[model samples]
Target: MIPLIEARGLVRIYEIRKGPFSRPQPVRAVDDLSLSVMPGETVGIVGESGSGKSTLGRMLLGIDRAQAGEVIFDGRQMPPLHSQQWRALRAKMQLVYQDPLAALDRRLTISAQIGEPLDIHGIGSKEERKERVRELMGAVGLRPDQAGRYPHELSGGQRQRAVIARALAARPSLLICDEPVSALDVSIQAQVVNMLRDLQEQNGIAMVFISHDLKVVRNIADRVAVMYLGKIVEEGSSDTIFQFPRHPYTKALVSSVPVPGKRLQGRVILQGEPPNPAARPSGCAFHPRCPLATDICRTRTPELRRIETGRTAACHLLANDLAVAA
Candidate 1:
């Protein structure tokens, strides 16, 4: 089956200048990364900050142009950014940001904000838009009377629900949610996550859910992709990746998740900060902190390859260890 969204060898770079007289240095925010999201499938992207998860999300939505590679949505290559074709295609793709308050217009009523997309996309008549907005409010668990409330009138969770309602107004086939529930309280986070799962199942929306929270990802994602230094170090079924991670970076990340009633023992605590993207390490970016790093890991970059059925990892040591085990 053709993927609803496909990203191939996507690369994004930024030039940072140290000083007025210094030449700008190019930083690869997103390295050559490829991923596919099937219809109604939720793919979780988890990593530490600056791992390019947000950048990857933007690239997938065609909001950020890649320095290299192409994104194909629903089998056709994505149109040029901000072009007429792209604008038309935007209705089928939407983004839910971390800060709902920031995403929403402070001056506009929740109803108006949710209906804005319908108006912008020319989806329905004015009366039809109003009715749709009403339905949306109800769908997201907002009361009819709350429609007139401004962003500040609502609580954090309500604000996020309003944002989700707006994103879904156009019925997007693919949704890229970057840290969607990160700002909410634990109880509210569970509510929003459950709502998202329900919405995906009901609308059959394929989602690229990016977050640093492994527990949440494990709860909502069909598959999980672990990224390190702008590259996907490991990817597999959510259960498989969480239960038996193949890559060292993935192991460290999974181990860091605190389990209830279980004391932290043998947890892999990585040393040192992530290397500067502008001056990435020679070979494996994680080698400097990896306990299993060998001379090969220090000298040659390992390619992401199949480590087992339905699982892949980019680590030389893992491949060698798996081979020896076999």
Candidate 2:
């Protein structure tokens, strides 16, 4: 079956200048990243800050232009940003931001914000839109009485639910949730996560969930993609990647997640900080901090290759494992 969304060879760059005399250096925020999400499937992208996870999400949605690569929704290439075709396509894709207050309008009431998409797309009549807003409120676990309140009037969790309701008002096929639950309290985060799962199961919505929380991703994602310096270093089923990570970077990340009843005695703690994107290392971007790095890893870039039936990793050491397994 064709993927609901596919990103191919995506590259996003940003230019930054430190001083008046210095030249603007180009930083590759996303580099040659490829990923896909099937209908009703959740693909979790996990990485530290500045790893380009959020940039990749924006590029996937066409909110940010890529210097190279294409995003295909369903089967066709995505339309150019802000084009008439793209405007029409927007109705089928939505973004849920990390901060609900920032995403919601301070002046608009919750009901108005929830029904705004319908008004913009001209989806239903006034009465129908009003009823739909109420239904959406209930779907996201919001009370109908809170509909008339402004964003400031609602709690953080309630505001987030309002934002989600608005995103779903148009019935989007794809939802890119960037740190959707990171800002909420732990208890609220679980509620929202469960709600997201329920919504996806009911509507068969495809999702790209980007977060730094490995445990959260492991809970909600069918597949997990571990990113480093804008490239996907490892990709596989959540269970495989989390339980038996092949890449050193992935292993380090998984080891960091605290396991109950287990001590942190032999965790694979990485040594150095992530290299600056503006000046990435020559071969494997992760070699500088990887404990298993060899001379070959310092001189040659490893392509992402299948290591198991449904798992892939971009590491020189994994190549030997593949040969042994073969």
Candidate 3:
């Protein structure tokens, strides 16, 4: 089957002005990257902070404009912002942010927040909207009476549910979840994650799940994409990527996951931090910190290539030999 969402050579750059008179410097939050999600599949994007996961997620949802490349949804290229087609396309794509409380209006009641989309699109009458809002609340596992309560009146989990309910109100075919449960308590996080999974199963909604927690990703994602320095370094089936990571960065990330009663061997933490986008390192962006870095890796960037069936990694060491230094 064709993919529900496809991002090709996606690039998103932000301009930072050092001074009022200084020239604006471009920060490549998301570099030339591409990925896709089949219908009803969950693709997890995992990375460290500042790895551009969130930016990529935002660009995928049409919340942030890409500087270049294409974002195709259901086989149609999303038009540029301010265009009628763009508005229409966004109606089928929605986003669930990290902080539910912050995303919601403090003063607006839960009913008002979830029903806002129905009102915007004129989906139904006042009576119908109210009924839909109640259903939405129940869908997210909240009581119908909670509708009249303000955001502050609800617990953290309830607030997150409200946000999810709002997103579902659009009946979107694709959902971008940007650390949707990171802010909640552990027990609450499980509840939210299970709820999201159940909803996806029932609605057949394709999702791009972005988070720093690999453990969480393992629980929900069918496939996984590991990103570094604004680019996807490795991607494959979640089971393969988690069990037999080929990329050095992927191995290091996997090593960092704590196992019960057993101490993990030396970690692959690179020496220096990620380079600033304005001055990205020459050749492979990860070469500087890669323990397996060779002369070729220093000056030549490796294109993403399939190492095994359904698994791809961008690494010089993996090209000529299967033995990757990690």
Candidate 4:
């Protein structure tokens, strides 16, 4: 089956301006990354801060253009930003931001914000759009009375629901949710996550869930991608990744998640901070933090290759067609 959205070898760089009279430093926010999401599939992208997860999300939606490579949505190349074609395409792909208050207009009521997308896409008549807005508010579990309330008047969870309601207002084919529930409480996070999952399954919407929370990703994703320093270190089925991580970075990330009622015995605690993008490491970016780094890991970059069916990882220690770790 053809993917709903595909990013091929995307590269995005930002030039950071330093002190007075200092030259700008180049930071490759996303480097040579590629991904695709099939209809009704959820691909979770998990990584540390500055790993380019958010950058890749914007690039996939064409909000951030790549210096190299292309993005194809529904078999058509993404158009230039703000173009007519891009505007029309926006109705099919939507983004759910991490912060709800920031995403919503303070002056407008929740119902107005939810109904705005229908107006933008010209989806229906005035009465039909109003009905659709009411249905969406109900779908996201928002109360009828809360419709007229401003963003600041609602709780964090309620505000997030409003944001989600607005995103769904467009009936997008693909939803890119970037840390959508990170700001909410644990219980609220579960509610929102389950709501998103149910909504996706019911609508058959493809999703790209980007988060730093591994547990949440494990719950929502069919496939998982472990990224570090703008590169995908591991990609595979979510179960294989959580149970039998092969890459050292993937292992460390999975180990960081505390298992319920279990004491930490074989946890892989990594040392040192991730290298700055302006001055990335010589060979493998994770070598500075990898516990098993060797001469080869420090001298050459490992390509992300298949170690087995439905699994791929980049690590110098792993042999071809064989895993270094179970």
Q: Which regions in candidate 1 have their CA more than 4 angstroms from the true location? A: 321-326
lDDT (tens digit, per residue) of candidate 2 on 244-264:
887888888888788899887
lDDT, candidate 3, 173-217, per-residue tens: 999999999999989999999999999999999999999889889
Residue 217 C-alpha lDDT in model 3: 95
- Return the candidate ranking by lDDT, descending: 1, 4, 2, 3
Candidate 4 lDDT, tens digit per residue, 210-311? Answer: 999999999999999999999999999998788888898988888888878878777677778865888789788899888778888888988888878998
Candidate 4: C-alpha lDDT: 0.91
Q: By summed lDDT, which 10 consecutive residues of candidate 2 come out lowest?
A: 317-326
2 or 4: which has the higher TM-score?
4
TM-scores, all candidates, are 0.97, 0.96, 0.94, 0.97
Query: TM-score of model 2 relative to the true fold?
Result: 0.96
Per-residue error at 323 for model 1, in Å? 6.0
Q: In angstroms, give how far residue 77 of model 3 lies from its true place.
A: 1.3
lDDT of predicted model 1: 0.91
| Model 4 poorest 10 in a row by lDDT | 317-326
